[model samples]
Target: MQAPQTKEEKQLDISLDELIYKVRELKQSIAGFIYKLENEYQHISWPNMMEHFGVLSSQLNSVKRLLKTSKMPLLRNYVLFPLRLSPDRDLELEKLTEGRVMAFSHEVVPDYLRTKPEPEVEERVQMMSVKASSMAPDTTQKQLTNLNKITANLLDTISVPSASDEREKDSSLKNALPQTSSQQDTNLLIGAITKGHRLLRPEPQSPMVVGPQMGQMQPQMQQQHPHKLQMPGASMGRMPSAIKTNIKAAATSHPYQRP
Candidate 1:
């Protein structure tokens, strides 16, 4: 007689694809239930309403239970506060880390990270930090001073003028200009005199006949003297007298001559 053979175990693992299909089918069933109630309400009697609601409730509960028991859990997002951990901050780190579950897989870690820092190395690091801290202000101050000088040089090069300078320039220009009417006239007269021209006396005409008429003309000459020939009171429209018209001066070497 042969011994009884054992049956093979069925695969029990459910993949994400199977979960998605089941969830999609449940969602479709619930959606179709709502659609049916909305579309067939006029035809549906009051006795079928409770049954329809019951079917909807069962379908929703099935989907909820499936999601709760599935391999993938619901994801919740929250803010992660930034923190820096140091030897002095160990208490805060411990408080943060207390009662926190940790999970990890096999990963390669560098051996250098596992080794503790030597005391001499820590001392050198602290000294270097101190030296850097001491030099920071000096370097920053030097750079700031250099930038200030550069700005000052740029301001000088740009030549931003003041109102006072403009006023001074205007005042100088005004001073250079002629200030008085007399001065302006003098300037115009000088310009005219320098235009290459010279003044000359007028030409002479006929001389006086003083041979016989000297005695008789003495009284008339006294009445109408050379200064009285062009009388200011004479009528401009009147013809000149024969004696005054014929009594013109002769040309002479002398600059002064009588009429």
Candidate 2:
């Protein structure tokens, strides 16, 4: 049988349900706004359209903040919350919220906010149009010529680097990079070599055989070599001839010098 949930787990489930309710409310609010935008304000002017966009934008941000602050991992997984009316509704809500936010930012807001030649903008547009219609063809051509000259002067004033300047910049970057890289490479190589030497270097071998058996061999070794017994903790059995030769060779050899 499955164990019952602790108090904390029960509280967490309650909080998560409350969070889902808030998200659902926000989603309904966005749906209502979209409905109004489509039906009530089918041909909204710039100012009125922006006011609607602002309300929707603020609602979306609040939903985003709610999702962020909830700190509940299960809310992100659609499969976990099967108790809801629609198991996949939370995922759909997230997608709808994101889509609305993007639509407002990209399509509706930018188009409405941009300067357009609207009749309500000012009387200047009408005046300009009337003046353009009354102007002589030769005089218009002269004005166009002057405008082109002014644009060309502006373009000339915007400095662009020459091929030589680009080449110099490329060469300087290339020169600076190699010196630093070479120094770093050399240091790394030396460090690797030093580490290898330290790892491969022979350590002083301790006598493997110890205790009672080793103690028993002391007297026999003393008779064979009396002077050697004077050394402290000296083992009585001399190491095998082959092992002695190998140990001496290892001790004498330098790590850098290959065998």
**lDDT, model 2, position 56:** 66
The predictions' CA RMSDs to the true structure, in order, are: 37.0, 28.3
- Please list the residue runs of candidate 1 whose C-alpha ends up more than 4 Å from where it truly belongs after superposition: 1-15, 73-259
lDDT of 2 by residue, 1-259 (tens): 2345565476567767867777777677678768877897857678877776787678777666766764554553443322323322255545766644333333344354455556665678788899998999999999999999999987765533343355678785765356455765564456436433111212214444345445545554435233234333333222333434576676666476656
Clash count for each candidate, listed in order shown: 0, 0
Most TM-score-accurate candidate: 2
Candidate 1, residue 235: lDDT = 27
- For model 2 the local lDDT of residue 48 reads 74
Give each model's whole-structure lDDT: 0.49, 0.56
Cα lDDT of model 1 by residue, 85-127, tens digit: 2333245434544523121112212222235467788899999
lDDT of 1 at 66: 66
